[model samples]
Target: MKTIIKAPPRRKPQSAGATTNRPGNPATGKRLPYGLADCVIFLAIAIPLLIAMCATGRPGA
Candidate 1:
């Protein structure tokens, strides 16, 4: 009976702050003005939907 040894797959080397290290990447670390603009736009759409749903909701249904 011959035993086969399977070696573990090698992993690629990652930099010290490659992933989720926001401070290392300024572009990803800080929120842009456009992000706030997008939030405002999303809120504008969401609030109206919420109000409409509330106003039209049936008591039992």
Candidate 2:
């Protein structure tokens, strides 16, 4: 029989000089810049695949 071990949940440490209620920190609130960059990168890869799929639809046109 094997025993299962569970890890403890991680907690975020509060900044010394920063306010915990501020909107800049991603761990505490929304991160627009990072989210936008991620979306752009995803679209960059997806667009090429979409174009390739469309181009191949004409049976080697």
Candidate 3:
């Protein structure tokens, strides 16, 4: 009674002409501008929420 263990298959190499489907790695154009815009929008929404939370929690509103 011997158990035969099977090995997992290896991944295939990408072709030179194959397009990358991953984010933040566009084949053409820049990805940094969009990233910065996202950061700015996030901070804009977060700052007000934090300030409101602090204001409401204060003893003297």
Best of the candidates, TM-score: 1
Which run of 10 residues does model 3 get worst, by summed lDDT?
Answer: 24-33
Q: What is the C-alpha RMSD of each candidate to the true structure, in Å?
A: 5.6, 9.5, 6.7
Choose the strongest candidate by lDDT: 1
Q: Evaluate model 3: give its TM-score.
A: 0.40
Of candidates 3 and 1, the better by lDDT: 1
TM-score of each: 0.44, 0.38, 0.40
lDDT tens per residue, model 2, 1-61: 9999989988898788775555665577545567878899999999999999998798757
Q: What global local distance difference test value does model 1 have?
A: 0.85
Off by over 4 Å in 3: 1-34, 58-61
Model 2 earns a TM-score of: 0.38
Q: Give the per-residue lDDT digits (tens) of candidate 1, residues 1-61.
A: 9999999999999887786644755676566667878999999999999999999999888
Query: What is the lDDT ranking, best to worst?
Result: 1, 3, 2
Q: Total clashes, candidate 3?
A: 0
